[model samples]
Target: MPTTRSALMVAATAAMLAGCAKPPEAPPPSSSAYRVYVTNEASGDMSVIDSATMNVIATVPLGKRPRGIHASPDGKTIYVALSGSPIAGPGMDESTLPPPDKSADGIGVFDVKQNKLVRVIHSGSDPENFDISKDGKRLYVSNEDVAGVSVLDLEHEKVIATLQTGEEPEGVRISPDGRWVFVTSEDAGTIAVVDTAANKVVNSFKVGRRPRSIAFLPDSATAWVNAENDGTVVLVDAVKHTVVDTVQLGERGVVKPMAVLLSPDASTLYVSTGRGKKVFILDVATRKVQASIEVGQRPWGIALSPDGKTLYSANGPSNDISVVDLATRQVSQKVKLTGSPWGVITLEQ
Candidate 1:
């Protein structure tokens, strides 16, 4: 019974309302694919490589000396360690040294979506390596010079606690359950196990000379500490907090093992020998070297893909990443970077 104009207006309004209705929901993310991020220390840049393509898709510029790199558990952000320390020693004192021309020596936060460095969170002095809590609420950063761990609250983006550790803490890792943090002391040759809830060092155990890197098995029952100077990997039982076994990788004075990585299934362990220029694959059950692949010179960091089909080693002197196919057990590809690539991390989207 409405007039013609009124009828037309009503129809137009109904049509507009229909158009404003929500569209169909977006499909979920592809579960099969992922990305890999590698930090180049000398180049001051990071390389973003597509897992499927094995090609460098983007290069993100970060602060000077971007070394230790880690991806958030959600795969939403990448944290890189930017050291402002002097090339010779820990440069002049922070107060006396000239202010940084750009970003300071801290954690460079990169938003994965934008592929850019979004912020630099000031950690303690000489933030070398770091680890995030299992719940993703806290970040434990190892300040090498300060000889402690700076616990950063992710939600607040500030350092809330600094727990004193051994001398020259180089590698820091949180347990899978998020209850304990293990820090390796390069100069002290010890590992400090921190109880997260209590925020205290529960125990400190002796390791080999210069414990530079640490890795835990998937079950979280055992951990492997790499002694760079001793050329050995010490296996520690987490519960007992004791060294259960020590597997010698290279000769007493020949090889230098820098980083340790476990396979996705936790059946194999991989160690990068710096002076040997080889990646040693060890069978976890037997604690013996199963294979050794000659990689580039001075491989400092190593990471395995999600599927455990590929291994990536960052060769410092070669300034390239050696991609080894797990099945073939050889270098499949070497991706060149701008500078010395040290920290390599794989991301599954």
Candidate 2:
């Protein structure tokens, strides 16, 4: 009944409208083969590797500064902390740096099976790191610039609360019992402990200079925090929230601890020494360094193998992953990558 020109115009308008419509909720990740996901901060991409073959499978492009990464309980999805903040350190003037890209500041959720980023949830501002609750319903994210912890409701995709923390919060972890959450403040040189049940900062204690990373034992009764500037790893009593012991990794300027991981049997703690070009293996009970293996240049993010036989570390400067054999306590292989890998996490079959 209408002219063809008018009908085509209407069809074009409808198509445009549909394109502008909001996207629907994404489905959960499906079952996939076991693989290791490495976040490359400099390249803004994630490198997927075949664990069995120790070969890189694919490179998934993400947003800027994909630093912290964690796998969901079911291993169906992986969350990445993508920030827009300008990187600053002890002596740098932050005012001279460019403004943060607000649009890129969010938590990127990658579907395991699809091997792609399906959603990006707002995480307040400059979420450098985060820890998910045991039930996978909440995220305690560290907002570096604002010095606050943003608690977001995972299912609803909304922030329910914001808890104050020390200046420049970075490292974040949840207790195994799910009773407490710990965030390390680099500038404050302290650990802010949040009582999840009360939804408040229950305690705060200084460990040493520049606490960057943390790891908990299997029982979660104790925690190890790496004091970067001090080049030491301090043990903390989780329940009491107090420093119990300290194990020095290397000389102050030579050995900077960036990441720590616990053995499955809880007998040892593997530490990645930034700029030290090595990973320190410490005996847990004795609190002493048993051995140190040369990895690569500035090994930052580290992860344990499923079978507890090998260790993987993301070496930033070298742009590769150092694979260490636990039994041999040495680096067995180095998987080459093109980007500056910052964080590493593994998903199993």
Candidate 3:
């Protein structure tokens, strides 16, 4: 009798489940959802490109010299570095140029869904570039003119701490573990490794002449610094806080490296040579340049998709974005951007 009751209960439960409404299937990804955002530094604006159509849909005016772009880890917001510091060349005298409009320095925050500039937030004077924490609670900003990095609290939009750095700090990168931040001092030619918890420069080491940009591995075990003037990529051991090796990008005075990008798996690296007009493919284990893909002239910033299928480079001199097919290692398209493109970031829906 007990077995019969158990069978009856099972039958009743199955009948109830069968009569219940079925769950709906998830929809496929929309083709037009992918987008590429390019910052035009010289134009003081940013252009939004629709990747599906390969056409620029809109250009939003930002403050003076919009550069160094990065999206929040959640992909809901984008932050761009904006500055009004007088633009002076290498040989130009700073005194002759107009004083940096400290008032014009700020970080522009944009809403992804709204497709509009939400507000302009100021962290410190001349926020040239910055890196947001994984939790999106903080931002480490490299103040180009001030020779330090301003750590800003995201919720309040105010600088919480200032970490001293070398002269003319330009590039700021945070480790995956969030324990350290590596800042490149352009004029000082050194990397200032900061311990975020202590909010101070923990270690400093010479990389090469004019280290402008840097990229780190997923494990935070190694980092690569772009030695622009020397035309080489100096590899650094993050754990040891030392320069492990140096890999030459191109000939002297010809291949000025502007940026370094690591693959999703950290097995390969891609370097954008500024004057070389090409992106070099590197094998991680061997640390050798396997091949070079010719991109537009003066490629400055580089970004890769989540799937690592497509690569985008902001070509400054040519005023365009070179879309490269990583599988084929060839230029698939050149999307024209009217202004001088400085930095680029892409999001795939």
**Candidate 3 lDDT over residue span 1-349, tens digit each:** 5698899999999988987767766753236757889999899999988778788888988889899899998999999999989776556788898888887798999888877888888878888889999999999999988899999999998888988899999999999999999999988899999999989898898999888888898888999889989989989999998889999988978998878988888888888988899899899889999999999898989998777888999998789999999999999999999779999988865
Best first by lDDT, ranked: 2, 3, 1
Q: What lDDT tens digits, residue by residue, belong to model 2 across residues 81-127?
A: 99987766567998899999989999999998788999999998999
Comparison by lDDT, 2 against 3, better one:
2
User: How far is 211's C-alpha from truth in model 2 (Å)?
Assistant: 0.7
lDDT of 1 by residue, 224-342 (tens): 99988888999999888888999998796578888988887788999999878999999999999998999998898899888889999999888889999989998998988778888
Those runs of model 3 whose alpha carbons end farther than 4 Å from true positions after fitting are 1-33
TM-score of each: 0.86, 0.89, 0.89
- When 1 and 2 are scored with lDDT, the better candidate is 2
Which RMSD values do the candidates have, in order?
6.0, 8.5, 9.5
Clashing pairs in 2: none
- Spell out the clash pairs found in candidate 3: none
Q: Clashes in each model (backbone N, CA, C under 3 Å)?
A: 1, 0, 0
A best-first ranking of the candidates according to their TM-score comes to 3, 2, 1
